[model samples]
Target: MLKSWTAMFAAGSVISLLVVVSSTSALRGQPQPGLAVASAGSIHLALGNPSGATEDPANKDNFLVSKPQYALSYNDANGIANWVSWRLNKNDLGIQGRCKDSRGRDFFAADDSLPTGFKQIKPDEYDFPVNGFDRGHMAPSADRTANRPDNCATFLMTNMVPQRPNLNRQVWESLESDSRQLVTRNGRELYIIAGPGTKRGTIADNRVMVPASTWKVVVVLDAPELGLAGVNRNTRVIAVNMPNTKTISGNWRSYLVNVDQIEALTGLDLL
Candidate 1:
């Protein structure tokens, strides 16, 4: 139905299809075609795709939500000021997971994750008691609590990459705070898509990195009240890729713009 409608109706609808569903790692010199710059978080970008023709990584259809909350980080240099541990779920799953099957490797396998999202897998058959890479998290513990594992399951080793201690302990913690704040503010459930980094092809030398280098994390916030529309109407989306810079430095697409400029850019009544 959706495919036929776009084929029959809008011409622009075509490009919108693939871009809506894909989340690429940081690109070299291009901002994602349809995203806008967001002001909040270490990185921010978002867009509206009412069609639902494309599948989102964080889309609820592909995943389920569990206890996602923030818990305080014991390693916070700032002490009690650092209250984190938002989403808490184990990555390694038992047998019978949707993506797991005894015949194949586990999607959340620590040292032995099979090719996930491509096929079905079982738990016992997974590369368990594995080693090498950390059980990384797409949705860090800084964002969830003791809840359902499906949503938390999405944050498993498959979506994890070995992050640096400083990045996780301090920097990413900040990003976590912002993520929780938004979900709290929305009052409506938000969908989050996250996955682990792979070390197979071009990144042959790279392990599932624990510390985020270049810090190209991205955040997308929607809902009229956020004032996102005021920025760049063409891209009511925020885009910023990890810069590959040594110190993990970057800013939001909205960092340079003010609320007024955003209002002008989007022509929305953001003020």
Candidate 2:
């Protein structure tokens, strides 16, 4: 499936029915080998991008080229990601490298590098405090604090979606902390993919879609290599689907689910 998708991606412009999409030169750095593309912009994430799902040509879906820190399948019409994928390890936890600017903002401008006709969303456009939602991080910023590029990439509006405040600040935040600890305990790398289930429709002038629920798939591996060889029946896979509402409690663990369930809900091949 990955091979087929790669073939299509290599074809380029096959899915030209998109509303707007953009691409830009990658940042200057040693490219991470093995991945299909070593993002041109910043330091590439260790796990590589996820693949296997085909986009509907009628919709405004497009694969946003991977940046150094993370990669996303962006939906240009709704101005959000279908999914965001990246790698995380204990080394990414502390020691702030030069990923942010002096003004304390993301090094990359919101959607600045997207393809030419794509409708880019800005960071402050969410109006979180006024809109009663948070500009939630699909690839969380706190998890990539180890350096500037990785951390700053998480702030891109392309990596954000409208999330309820309680879910973003409380339960979701706690779960993120736990994920880091899980890596520290096992001493391995984790590949994570997260996105929204936007059954609830849009918010804030219909600019950002409101997901009825948000979901995540975490693949724990002792090494970094593509394919199902590393993941088996016994492989540790964590999947969670949390409601997009204010009633969620602080315990994110309570929302745990199986990877199979997430795959069914998302219609994406995670492995």
Candidate 3:
């Protein structure tokens, strides 16, 4: 089955491969088919899904959504993505810039792709004047600058979580820049997974959960063609669990952690 799936993936039948995997899982009575197999190409999630997310209505918290730019497991109850996964190569970088308004603020659009009845968070919800948080991107806007729609998709509210202004602007932003440098400078391809961890509080009148920490796992491969098959003992995996608080400061490397620790904290298997 693995060999067949690899052949199908190599043939570029990503959607067809997903259908087969889903059908086979149903017949075997396993947990609903995960999106990992569904996203096994140069598209988003070249490695695999960390959480077993599916489109099943019953699994609203871990509902899977695949976009041209990236893939994510959106948690309806929490009103944020459980995790976002994307493949980043040098070709994905461009000068398209971030989707912003005339005021130079990011255009946080509501995601209409979510099914009816799921709470669609609006942009104004993050407009707290006193103790407001920045709309942090799980998959940073800079990572998807290949085109207009690709960059615009990063601004969707589903891809956001309430992050401290300092954390988002400083340390987190630095790491995002460094990730891009890996592609531009070293010519490495990265498979990244990021999400919030441990609800710290509530925002947007309790509509959105503020996570205590933001975690990410970056799998860096020497070349884009290698994909998942390239991962080995020597593969460089950078995982960090940064606190989502104003007091946090300094380099993102200070908050470095092992992948297993991040998995234990967020309850997701990140490879």
Question: Against the true structure, whose lDDT is highest?
Answer: 3
Write model 2 residue lDDT over 1-271, tens digit each, in one string: 1111111111120111111111112211123343244442323223333342123333357554576667777887778888887777777778775356689654545777776777778766777677777888888887788876667777788888888889998888887777777777777677788988756877657877888889886656655343223433334556788999978885776787655566577776553
Stretches of model 2 off by over 4 angstroms after superposition: 1-59, 97-108, 223-232
Error of 2 at 73 (Å): 0.2
* Candidate ordering by lDDT (highest first): 3, 2, 1
* Model 3 per-residue lDDT tens digits across residues 48-153: 5567677766788988888888888899999999999888898889899889878998788999999888989998888757557988998999998888888999
How well is each residue in 1-271 modelled by candidate 1, as lDDT tens digits? 1111111111221111112212222122122344222211112112222112112223322221112232111111111111111211122113333343357543454312222332222222222244222333445543434333543454443334444344444444455455455555543222232222221211212222222222222223344243322222221222112221224433223222222333233222211
Candidate 3's displacement at residue 78, Å, is: 0.5
Whole-model Cα lDDT per candidate? 0.28, 0.64, 0.76
Question: Least accurate stretch of 10 residues (summed lDDT) in model 2?
Answer: 7-16
lDDT for model 3 comes to 0.76
**What is the lDDT, from 0 to 100, of the residue 22 in candidate 2?**
16
Q: Hey, what RMSD does candidate 3 come out at?
A: 8.1
The regions of model 1 sitting more than 4 angstroms off are 1-135, 142-146, 151-155, 186-271
Model 2, residue 169: distance off in Å is 1.0
Cα-based TM-score, every candidate: 0.34, 0.74, 0.84
